[model samples]
Structure formats: C-alpha cells, structure tokens
Target chain A: MARLTLDRTRQQALSVSVATGAYGISFGALSVAAGLDVWQTCALSLLVFSGGSQFAFVGVIGAGGGAGAAVATSAFLGLRNGFYGVGLAPVLRPMRGWRKAWAAQVTIDESTAVALAQPAEDLPARRAGFWWTGVGVFVAWNAITLLGALLGSRIGDPADWGLDAAAAAAFLALVWPRLAHRRARAVAAASSLLALALTPVAPPGVPVLAAALVAIAAGWGHPRPEEVPE
Target chain B: MSAYAWMWVAIVAAGVLSWATKHAGHSVPESWLENPRVHRIAAFVTVALLSALVAVQTFASGRSLVVDARVAALAVAAVLLWRRAPFIVVVVAAAGVAAGLRALGWG
Candidate 1:
C-alpha cells in the first residue's frame, strides 16, 4: 500500500511539473517583451524561480515602473512561497548547509501542494513528491524560458503576436484555481476592481500593492463561510 | 541608470528577497505558522495579487486604461478555462485571438 501511494505521488508530481513548467514559455516570452534580454530572462527563471513573481516583475518593468516597484511587486507576489516552506518544513525534515538552501529555494506552490496532498503519515512519499516536482519544474522552467525568449524576440511586435493577451490569460489561469473559495472570490473581485480603479491615478506598481491590502483586510478574523481548500 | 542596468538590479534584489522569504518559512518555528489566519491571509494574498495582475495586464497601458484585443483574448481564455482546457491551449488560444483581432484592425 505504501509503495503504491508513493508511486501515485510521484506520478502526480511529474504531471504537475510538466503542466506548471510549460507555462515558463509565457514567462520567457513575456519577459523579453517586458524588455529583459534573453540572458536576463533566463536569470530571472534561474534565480527567482516563482511564476507569479517573475511575471509581476516583468509586468511592472514593462509598464515603465521603476526598479524599486518591480522588486517590491515581485517580492509581494513571492510571499506565499515562504508560507509553503513553513507548511513543508516538518515533512521535509531538518537539513544543513547547501542541502537546506536548495530545499528552501525549491519550496514553491506546485512542490508544496504535491507534498502536502500525499498521505500525511507517509513522510518518504511526501518528500519524494516535493523534491521531484520542485527540481523537475526548475529544470523544465529554465529550459522553456530560454526557448520562449528566443521565440519571443523573433516574433515582432508583441501586440501583433497577441503576446500581451497571452500575458493576461496567464495571470487569469494562475488565479483561476484559487478562486474556488468564496472568500477568495470576493478578494479577487475586490482586488481586480481596486487595481482597475487605481491604474489611471497611481504609479505602475502601486495599484497592485493597494489591491493586496484588500486581501489582508478581508482575510483578518474568520468564519465568514469557513475557508475552503486551496 | 539605464533601463537594462535597472533591470539587472531589480532581478538581483528580487531574487535575494524571494529566496529569503522561502527560507524564512523553513527556519521559523512551525508553531508560528499554525495560525489559521496566517494561512488564510497568505492564500488570499495570492488570489489578490494574481487577479490584480490580470487586470493590469488586460486593461492598463502605462498609467492609463485602454480597451483592446487583449480584452477579447482574455474573454476567450476565460471561456477555455471554464471548460478546463490545458494551460498551453488556453494560452495559445488567447494569443491567437489577440493576434487575429489585430490583423483584422479591430483591436
């Protein structure tokens, strides 16, 4: 039974890695459109390694936002990864030095989700899920990012290629799965409205931060229809 | 600084902060993260930020808002998502919509 569960976990992680990593093409192409050189686009994938943050960084920069705003927006988008690390720590066990650092770096949404969804008592299965998904995503994401960057460069005006729309679609897809919760739906609606309202008056990145305040506010306290699974 | 120079700085700074945020979770006492409120807030924050990105990407151009092919493409993408299409298919369809609209000179 344990072996079977472990195999299933691995299969889940593998599929998730491919699905999630493939989105890096959008990230890669969009980063170039956002004005990153091919190498810079690749570096962002290698270093930042989070989908939402990478997109946020490029989105802000592409819109003529300053470096401060770009970094700030990307950082805000990345905050969830930390929480994932917190959730995964016990499952992953203690580590030291480089191994610990690598583990920390790979604690992302797909990895954490795959790990946590495993049978709670199966530490080995959970760990297998986390590492497989994380490392697999890392490799695939970086390689595809390079390919997208190259393709994006030769594609002419981004608007002509509808890369801009693709960018929007990517963001929508990302938030789609999370909107199943009632409160999350409310937060998303509120954030979208707040962002739209602030866009004209505010600086490029400020509106997004302002939108986050809505989530923080709504998320405080509890039991407004008990929170649903993420 | 030049735009590219600024991008480099942003890339490095964002990278360090992102890594640190992830590591902090592992290093912190697990008890700290046990709060339901914290998890809820984090999850909501993810939804909030991504939705905001969707808005900005779809509608805003510079400091102003505009209606364009991107909007139509977003609508298409939303429909595909409602049908549970694959991510690549959703993305490609979106790009195709926008690109096709632009070719028609209709935006």
Candidate 2:
C-alpha cells in the first residue's frame, strides 16, 4: 500500500506539472511580444520562475510603464509564493541551508497545492509530490518558454497572431479556479471595474496596483465564515 | 539610462525580489502567516490582480480603451473555459479567433 500510494503521488505530480508547464508557451510568446528579446525572455523564466509575476512584468513594460512600476507589479504578484513557502515548511521539515533555500525557490502554487492535498500524515508522499511537481514544472516551463519566445519573435504584429488575446485568456484561466466564493467574485468584479476605470487616467502599472486596493479593503475586515468558502 | 539598460535592471530586480519574497516565508514565524486576516487578504489580492490583468490586457490599448479583436477572442476563450477545455486549447482558440477576426477586418 505504501508503494502504491507513492506511485499515485508521482502520477499526480507529473500530470499537474505538464498541465501547468504547457502554459509557458503563452508566457513566452506574450513576453517576447511585450518587447523582451529571446534571451531576456528565457532569463525571466529561469530566474523569476513565477508565471504570474513574469507575465505582469511584461504586461507593465509592454504597456510602456516605467521600470519601477514593472518591478512593483511583478513583486506584488509574487507574494503568494512566499505564503506557499510558509505553508510548506512544516510538511517538508528538516530542510536547512541549501536544501531550505532550494525548497523555498520551488515553493509555488502547484507544489503547495499538491503537497497539501496528500494525506496529512504522509510526509514522505507529500515531499515526493512537492519535489516532483516543482522540478518537473521548472524544467518543462523553461524549455517551452524558450520555444515560444523564438516563435513569438518571428510572428510579426502580436495582434495579427492573436497573442494579445491569448494573454488575457491566460489570466482569466488562472483566476477562474479561485473565484469559487462569493466574496472573491465580488472582489474580482470590483477590481476589474476599478482597473478599467483607471486604465485611461493612470499609467499602465498604476491601474493594476490600484485594483489591488479593492482586495486589501475587502480583506482588512475580520474574517467571516463566508470569507473562505473553498 | 537607455530603455534597454533599464529593462535589464527591471528584470534582474524583479527576479531578486521574487526569490526574496519566497524565502521570507520559510524564515518568518508561522504565526505571522497563520493569521486569518493575512490569509484572506492574500487570497483576495491574487484574484484581484489576475482579474485586473484580464481586463487590462483585453480592453486597454495604451491610454485609450479600445474594442478590438481581443474582445471577441476573449469572449470565445471564456466559453471554452466555461466548458472546461484544457488550458492550451483555450489559449490556442483565443489566438485563432482573434487572428481570424483581424484577417476578415471585423474586429
């Protein structure tokens, strides 16, 4: 039974990694269209290694926002990765020094989700799930990103190839799973409207930052039962 | 600095900041992250940011808000997502719809 469970965990991790990694093509194409050269685009994947932050960075820069705004936007999008690290530390305990640092680097949404979904007492399975998903996604995401950047550069006007629309779709796909609760839905609606309103008045990065305030306001109050329906 | 130089800085800075944020969580006290308020805010912030990106990417073109091929493409993408299509399929469909619309000069 122990061996059977381990195999199941590995299977889950590999599937999740492939599904998540496939999205890297869109990121690569979008980043290149946003005006990063192929090498810079690949570098973003290698170093930053967060899909949402990398996309937001390109989105801000592609829209002509200053470097400060781009960095700020990307950084804000990266906050959840930190939270993931906190959540995973206990499950994958005994990590120290280089191992701890490496674990932190791989502590992303998929890894956290997969790790936490394992049977609570099954530390070995949880660790396997986390490492497999994290490393698998890292390799697949970077390799696919490079391919997309190469194709994106040769594709001429991004709009002509529909890459811009694909970027929006990618964002929508990401947030869709998270919008299970009423409060989240309300926040998403308000944030999008505020962002739309500010798009014309404020600079590119400012609107997204402003939209974040809606969430902060919604969340600052004491947590209610309905706050976390998931 | 030239735009090229600035971009390189932004890329490196963003990467460093990302790693720092991820690392901080591991080092911070568990109680700090366990706070319900912090958790709620983080969850909501993610939804808000992604939704905002979708709106901006689909509707905004520089200082002006324009309706173009992207809108139609996103509409199609939404249906595919609603029906539970795979991620890559949804993306490819959106791109195809937009490309088709632009080719026909209807967007």
Candidate 3:
C-alpha cells in the first residue's frame, strides 16, 4: 500500500513539474527577445526562479529602467511566495540543519499547491510530491531556459511567431484548473478588473501589487451566508 | 546602461529581497498558519495577486492599456473556464483563436 502511494505521489509531482517547467522556455526566449543577453537571461532563471518576478524584471529592463528599479520591482512581486512557505510549514516535515534551507529554496507555487491538494491520509506522499516537483521544475526550467536562450538568438522575432504568448498561455493553463468555486471565480474577476484599471496608472509591477491588495480586502470579510454552507 | 557597465548592485539587491520575502513566511511561528485571521488574509492575498496578473496579461501593453487579440482570447478563455472546459483545451482554444485573429489582420 505504501509503495503504491509513493508511486502515485511521484507521478503527480512529475506531471506538475513538467507542466511548470515547460513554461520556462517561454521565459527564456522572451527575456532574450526583450534585450537581455544569454548570461543575464540564464542568471534570472537560475537565481530568481520565479516566473512573475522574472517577467517583471525583464519588462522593466525592456522599458529602459535602471537595473536597480527593475530588481526592486521584481522583489516586491516575489514577496507572495514567502507567504506560501508560511502556510506550508505545518504540513511540511520538520527539518533541521541543511535540509531546512533546501526545503525553503524549493518551496514554489506548483509544489505548494500539489502538496496542499493531497489527501490527509497521504502525508508522506504529499511531501514526496512537493520535493520531487520542486527539484524537477528547477532542473527542467534551467535546462529548457538555456535551450530557449540559445535558440532565441537565431529566431528573427519571437513576437512575430507568437512565442511571446506562451508565458501568458501557460499561466492561464495553470489558473484555469483552480477556478472550481464561486469565491475563487469572484476573487479572480475582481482582481483582474482591479489590475486592468490600474495598469495605466502604475509602474510595471504595481498593478499586480494592487490586485493583491484588492483580493486581501475581499478576503477580509468571511464568505457570505449563501457563499458558505453549514 | 551599457551591457557590461550596468551596475549589478541592483540585481544583487533584488536577489536578496526576493530570497528574504520567499523565506520569511517559513520562519513565521507555526501558530500563525493555524490562525483563522491569517488564513483569511492569505486567501485574499492570493486572489488579489492572481487577479492582478491576469489583468496585466490581458490588458496592458508596455505603458498603455489596449484591447487586442490577446484580450479577446482571454475573454474566450474566461468563458470556457466558467463553462468547466478542461484546462488544456481552454488554453489551446484561446491561443488558437487569438493567433488566428492576428494572422487574419483583425487583431
């Protein structure tokens, strides 16, 4: 029984990992097309490793901002991942010494979501899923990023071929699966609307930050009586 | 900002900030995670964050707001998602619709 559970967990992790990792190609190609060099592009993937932040950083650079401004903006956007780590602490096995750092480094969106989605009975399996997905995504993302960066130089223009759309498409692919409830739907709608409204007024990353604030405000009040069932 | 002359101090700063933010939550006391207030805050924060991302992707182009094929495709995707279409199909259909529109010069 344990072996079967482990197998299932591994499969789940691999699937999520592949899906998340494949999107790195878009990031690599787009970042290079946005005017970054191969080394800078790879460094973003290796060090930043967060898609939203990477996009923000490159977007800022593309728009001719100083590197300092771009980095600050990306850092602001990446703060949410820290909150995910806090939420996952209870379910994640307690680790001491070096393992804790490893766990922290790998605590990303896909891993957190997959681990949290696991059944309570499959705690060990869930842990495996989290770790495997994180490691798999990290490896695949860097590798694919390298390939995309190299290929991007040869391609005339990524935008002309719609390569630029891949990142947004990939994000939608991940997001569509989670809109299973009314609250989620409502939150998504509200946040998207807020962002759309703010985009013209704010800097590159500011809209995202604004949308997050809106969602936080919406979450302040508990779901209405009709929204929750006894 | 020449490629080589661009100061890396900002990059290093950003990396430090990103790492700190990403790691801060893990260091929070365990009790906070279990607190209902914190849970509510986190939930709302997530919604807002996602909304913001979706909005920017759909509407913003550099410094301006413009509706185009991508926005149209996103509208289609939202409808499909609401209809409970499979995720893969939703993405493919939306991208196809947008790409086709652009190719046809309607976007």
Candidate 4:
C-alpha cells in the first residue's frame, strides 16, 4: 500500500493543513463571542489542539451551558483522537520522553488520518505524513487563531465562507479513497445514519461515539478480509 | 466554585484526559492490539466518526435536522472527490457551490 509518494503525502498534508487551519479563524471568533477572552481562546487551541473539541467547547458555552457541560462535551469529542493515537501507535512506535509528550500533543485527526492513508508498509512516508501534517496544522492553526481572536466579530461569519464545509470536505476526501471496500461502505452508511438519527436526541459527541460501535460490530461479522488470504 | 472556576478545573481535567489517552495507546501491548478485530475497528471507527462529525456539523442545529448550503456543498464535494479531483478542487468547488447558493438565498 506504499503507493503515496513522500512528495505527494507532503503536498496532501500541507494542503489539508492550510485549508483546515484557515478554518480556525472561525473557531477563534466563535470562542470569543462565546465570552472567552482572546487569551483563553488562544489557550484552548494551544493547549487542547483538537479543533472539533475546541469548537464543541465554545458551542456549548455560547449556548449558555455551564463549563462542566462544555468540558464534558469537548472531552468526549476528543476521545476520537485517542483512538487515532492507538491506531497509529505501531507506526509511531519508539517515541520517548519529551518527544513522546510532544507527539501526544499533536496526534490529532488530520495527522493520523493522513498518516494512516499511507500504505501500511511505507514507514518513512507514514512518519512524514504524521509529523508534517501535525506540525503544519499546529503552526497554522495557532497563528490563525491569534489573528481571528484579535479581529473578533469583524471577521464576519466564517460559516458563510463555507469553511464549515471545508473541514467536512477534507474529511470526506480522506474517506473517499477508502470507500472501495464493501464492508467499509456498509459501515460508513450504517454509522452515518446512526449518527444522524441520534443527532436529534443524543448529546453532541455521543452519536459519533455510538456510531463507533458499528466498527466493532462489523468486525465480528466480516472476519477481516485481509486475514483470509486471497 | 463559580462556573469560571469550574471552567479552569474542566480545562485542566480535559487536557489530562486527552493526554492520558494519547500516552495509553503507546503503552498498550503490541500483541493485544495486533488482533485483526482490533485493526478493523481502529481503521473503520475513524471513517465512521468523521462522517458522523460532518453530518452533525452540516445538518444539525441543536437537535434538529436542517438542510442548508453546507449539505449542498458536501454533495458537490463528494462528486469531486469520487471523480479523483485534486484536494483543493474538491474543497473549492464545494465551498463555491455552497457560497453561490447562499448568495442566491437558496441554502
């Protein structure tokens, strides 16, 4: 599966980084409007480093929910990053000490997704994808967050720019290539519908978490096609 | 504690939880995770969850389903992606369509 060139991976990683990073402008503005000062909003991006969770935090707060709910929601949304870390652990193995600590900080959605999209055997490309994507997103997201926070509501509606769609578009692009398998397609459909149906009732992150169960459930039935040996 | 005080507490708590989750994955035994079952779940969970995120982001507004330009953009983006267009093209086309629709007040 080592099909993606190092150069190609770098290009993909960088492009997605900039696109998703620019979307951070919207997050910064929203967080401030939600009553977080510029520094606190910046701190969230600096410290949390997970865009979905960061947005989930401000969204809850903007709605006047208590900080407890906000934290809980964001934390739950962030649980996906942990799973990403797990999936990539083998590929990113042998990390130690401060390097490991730093890696933990940046083991985010875009990084892991880009890295995993690499062929499993292309270790160098995988590592390159992970590090470049993570670092690229970090620098760009933080820099833009600072800019957006300072500008505040003057940035207008980031949503209207279709940035809200941009993030989704990036993720969809990642999933698009992997949809070749029947099981993958089935699981995607089931999970998406589950999440949609639950969106009206379940709290923000719960639907996604519940949808994750579909993967484990599918595993029981499909029996790992790769293991069967063609 | 005021909500502000709790906010501080919660932020620290969330950071710790997130960090721990990252580290724990590294420490997990390789053999334990090597099960193909584990691999399948790990791989597909991302796809499912990501699509789920997109769904909620584009269509849901506080427990209610609403169709808007975001959804329309997503559909166009899907077409671009399926045709193997480059990343920027897919995103730009998607956003352009959504923006065009909104400008016309269709979304």
Candidate 5:
C-alpha cells in the first residue's frame, strides 16, 4: 500500500508538471507577440513564474494600459498564490532554512493542491510531492517559454491559429477534474456569471478579480468543517 | 511609469505578499494553525478560487461572454471528468474538439 501510494504521488506530480509546463509555451509565444523581446519575456517567466499574472501583465501592456494599471492588475491576479500558501501550510509544514525559501518560491496552485490532498500521516511524502511537482513545472515551463519565444518569431500571428485558445484549453484541462461536488459546481457557476457580467465594465484582469471575490463569498457562506474525510 | 519599472514593482509586491501569507500562519502560535475552522476555511478558499478561475476561462473573454467552440469542448471535458476519465484523455479530447471545431470554421 505504501509503495502504491508513492507511485500514485509520483504520477500525480508528473502529470501536473507536464500540464503546467505545456501552458507556458503559450505565455512565451504571446509575450513576444505582445511586443516584448525574448529576454524580457524570459525574465518575466523566470521572475514572475505565475502563468495567470504574467498573462495579465502582458495583456494589459499589449492593450496600451499604463504601467500602474498593469502592475495593479497583475498584483490582483497574484492574490490567489497567497491563498495557496495558507492552504498548504498545515499539510506541507516547512522546517526553517533554505527549504523554507524553496517552499515559498514553489508554492503554486497545483503543488499546494497535491500536497494538501495527501494523507495526514504522509506529510513528508506530501512535501516531496509538492517540491517535485513545483520544481518540475517551473523548470519545464521556463524552458518551453524560451523555445516558444524563439519559435514565435517565425510563427507569424499566433491569434490566427488560436494559440490563445490553446492556453485556455490547457487551463480547462487542469480545472475540469476538480469540480467533484455540488457546492463546488454552484460556486463555479456563480463566479463565472459574476465575471461574465463584469467583463464589459472592468479591465482585462478586473473581471477575474471580481469573479474571485464572488467565489470567495460563496465559499465563505458555506463552511464545511475540516474533520470531514477527503 | 516605465514598463520594466512597473513590472519590477509588481514582482516585488507579489513576492512580498506571497512571503507574508505563507509565513503568517506559521508565525502565529501553533493554536491558530491547528484550529479546525482555520483549516476548513483554507480548504474551501482554495476550491473557491480554482472554481472561479475555471469559470472565468470557460465563459469570459476580455470583454465579452460568448458561447464558442471552447464552451462545447468544456462541456465534453466536464462530462468526461464526471465519468472519471483519465486526466490526459479528458484534456486531449477537449482540445481536439476545439481544434476540430476551429478547423470547420465554427469558432
């Protein structure tokens, strides 16, 4: 059983890393398409390392939004990462040292979710899963981003072939599997409706922010105790 | 603000915000982190955020909400997910559906 669990964790880490990495290619291609140089795009990928925020920043810049607006937008979208850390803190509790810094840098959505889903007795294994998945996604994503930026220069307009759709499709692929309950379904519907309604009234990232808030409210409305089995 | 300058500021802000949140629960007494209520909220918040993100991606573009090939593909993916299909299969099938629709000039 232990061996089986280990294998399952490894497989989950590998799957998430690959899926997350594949989406980075779109970011690279789109960043350059948005008028950023390869170095700029790579730097953003390396430093920002958050797909949604990077997309929002570039999208805002591409639309000729001011720098302040772009920064504000990106910051808003990044709020979820903060929440991710809070969720994973108990499951993958870090010991002080360089490990803590490494944990902080890699505390992304997939890593947190995978870690938190592990059994309570398997904390160490869970942390390993989180680290492996996070590092794997980060390294693979940046590498693909570089490749995409170089290839995008010659690929003409990405919009023609629906590269944007590719990114959305990739995200959907990650998200589709998580809606396992009625409450989750309802929250998703509410948040999406709110975002759709606000899309025309807000800027690129603002609708996402509005949706996030609505989802949070929905979630807060129904607080299920944590003792419930996974 | 210059583009690079603003980018740097945003990066710094994100880094700081991320660090603060990760360390907040840890810095507090062990009691707070151990609270059942806290854990519940954390779990629910993550789900909520993820749901919101998925919804936004499926239904909303930059400034409009239109039913397109992506939506159809999402429906297919959702069905497959409900049926407990493998993750890769679900994603590939959805992407294939979308790509096929685009090829047919329906997107």
Candidate 6:
C-alpha cells in the first residue's frame, strides 16, 4: 500500500466531487426537458442521490415512459450501488443500525470509486476517500442541480447548448479512466455496441441491463487473467 | 393518477428500492463478497453498464439511435480524458464542442 497522504486523498475527493457535481447542472436542465419542475429535479438529487438511477429515471420520463417504467429503470440502475455496498461492508461495518443506514444512503458511484481506487491495503486513505467524496458530491450535486433547473427554461432548447448531452458526457468521463487496460476497453466497446444494438428493439432502460449481461456472461463463462482483475 | 401524483410515487418507490440495495449490500457476508465470480462480474458490470449509459445518452434519442454533435463532443471528451486532463476540463470541453458545432449549424 502506498502511504497515501490525507492531502492527496482529499484532493482526489474534491476534484471528483466537483466534476460529478457539475453533472447535476445538466441533469437539472434535462429534467426540465423531461417535464420535471425545478423542485422535483432538486428533490431527485437530494433524496435519490444516485446519479445513474436519477438519470435513468428522468430519461425514461423524458421519453414518455410511464411512472412505473421510470421507477423500474431507476431501480435497475441502482442495483450497482448494492454491489458497491457489498464491497464496502467489511471496510465500513463499524457503523450499526441508523448510521449504517445513513452510510448506505450516500453509497453511490463516486464515493465507492474513490475508495476502491486507493491501493487495496491502505485502509485509512480508502476510508477518507469514501466519506470525503460522498459528502463533497452530495453538497455539490444538489447545489448545481438547483442552478441548472433554474437556468433550464431560459436556455430555450437545452440540446442547442448540448446540456442534453451533459449526462452522457459526465458518465463517459467517469468511465474513461477505468479503460486503462485493453480488456476493460474491449468490454466497454462491446457493451456499448450491445446497448446500441438493443436501442432500436428494446424498451427504455432495457439496453443498459442487456449490456450488463454481456459482462456477466463473459465473467461466468470465460475467466481470463486480464478480464478478471484481482 | 395525475403526473404529479405519479411523480411522487415513483420517487418514493425508487428511493426505497435504492436504499434497499445499499442496505442489503452491508448485510452480505465477506466470503460471498470475495468470490472470484462475484468480483469479476462486479468489475464487468461497472464497465459495461456505464458504457451503455454513454451510448444511450450520446446516440439514443427517445427510442432510436441518432448521431449528432454530441457524439463528436464525446469523442473530444474521450481524447481529453485519455490525455489525463482534469475532470472539469473534460466535461466542460465536451459541452463546449457540442454547443460550438450546434452554433455552426452542424449539430
């Protein structure tokens, strides 16, 4: 484990939080496109706090999917956070009952990513990364979402300014760093192609899940050294 | 139901479901967490699902996939990210490129 200084972890947390938080600006604008009021958009960021699910929720609604479909899509997107919780449980198990519940509420992609990005054995830095990134993103995400929603109607067509593209760009930026290896890149490209293929035939949000199946299939059937990081 | 009523219902349901996943994660045993299959699938899911998101957002509009300036902006963002640019720069750059192309009537 590299002796990661607290300062470095804090820097990483702040930077990721800011970047991920800025994503809320576009979300606010897009939610308006989806027919959500500013308060509704703000509430989603504040209460839901999960980026993938929030995006899926609004995207589904924006496309005229019913509320049931929107909820289902968001729920599916949120399942990853559960997986993240499993990974973090041993590390964060010190909390019990309500504190544990609260911790779980904030256990989204950014915090988990920062925590996991640290060298495996550096417990202190990893913990610092989790909490700092979680709180930082929460604060920044809500604030920026409000700003974006307020600006949404005035922006005329959000697509004209590419705010409609903001959510995709944000998620892509987050996924970009993980593509450092060849196999990960392959998985990404393959999965993207799968999603693209499914887009025309599948219902809303179904493509993303079908794409996840590609990874699961590869993982269970063909276990290669590069494909399975240890 | 009114749209507002359905909206609240969806929010509450999604919130409960989201919290359940996270809370359930905390209760899983360490042995299960360390399984090779689980680990590998988790990794794959991260890459694959997020990529799907990018694809969906970049090209998929409503029910169809459409190419537009957003794709070019995503390409620019990917290039900047590959170059190890800061996170904010990459995001801002993508939006700027997309907006620029639109302003030029090419979007």
Candidate closest to the true structure, highest TM-score: 4
lDDT (Cα, tens digit) per residue for candidate 2, span A1-230? 88977887787677667656766787889998888899899989988888878988999889988889989988887876765665566677656799887787787766765565466467898889889988988998999899889887554555677767766775576467667678878888899899899988885467766766887788889757566422
Q: Candidate 3 on B3-107: residue-level lDDT in tens?
A: 555635555566667767767766777677567656666655544565556567677887688878877787777677678665456656666777777788875
For model 1, name the residue pairs that clash: none
Model 1 chain A is weakest, by summed lDDT over 10 consecutive residues, at A221-230
At residue B36, give the lDDT of candidate 4.
72
- The alpha-carbon deviation from the true structure for residue B68 of candidate 3, after best TM-score superposition, in angstroms, is 2.3
Considering summed lDDT, which 10 consecutive residues are worst modelled in model 6 chain B? B41-50
Which window of ten consecutive residues has the lowest lDDT sum in model 5 chain A?
A: A221-230
Cα TM-score per model: 0.64, 0.64, 0.75, 0.90, 0.79, 0.76
What are the C-alpha RMSDs, in order, of all predicted structures? Answer: 5.8, 6.0, 4.5, 2.7, 3.9, 4.0
Docking class of 3: acceptable
lDDT of 3 at B68: 81
- Which ranges in model 5 have alpha carbons more than 4 Å from their true place? A116-125, A156-185, A207-230, B1-31
Misplaced by over 4 Å in model 3 are A1-37, A58-65, A87-100, A106-133, A156-181, A224-230, B1-10
In the range A1-230, model 6's lDDT, one tens digit per residue, is: 24546676677778677767877877888998899888888888877889878988999899999999888888887876776776565457667888888788889877876665554456787788789988999999999899989998564555666665654666676676567677778888999999999889986657876876877776786667565532
- The lDDT of each candidate is 0.78, 0.77, 0.67, 0.79, 0.65, 0.77
lDDT of 1 at B34: 66
Measured against the true two-chain complex, the DockQ scores of the candidates, in the order shown, are 0.48, 0.48, 0.45, 0.56, 0.40, 0.55
Ten contiguous residues with the weakest lDDT in model 3 chain A = A158-167
| Candidate 6 chain A lowest-lDDT run of ten | A221-230
**Model 6, residue B80: what's the lDDT?**
83
Candidate 5 local Cα displacement, residue A209, angstroms: 4.1
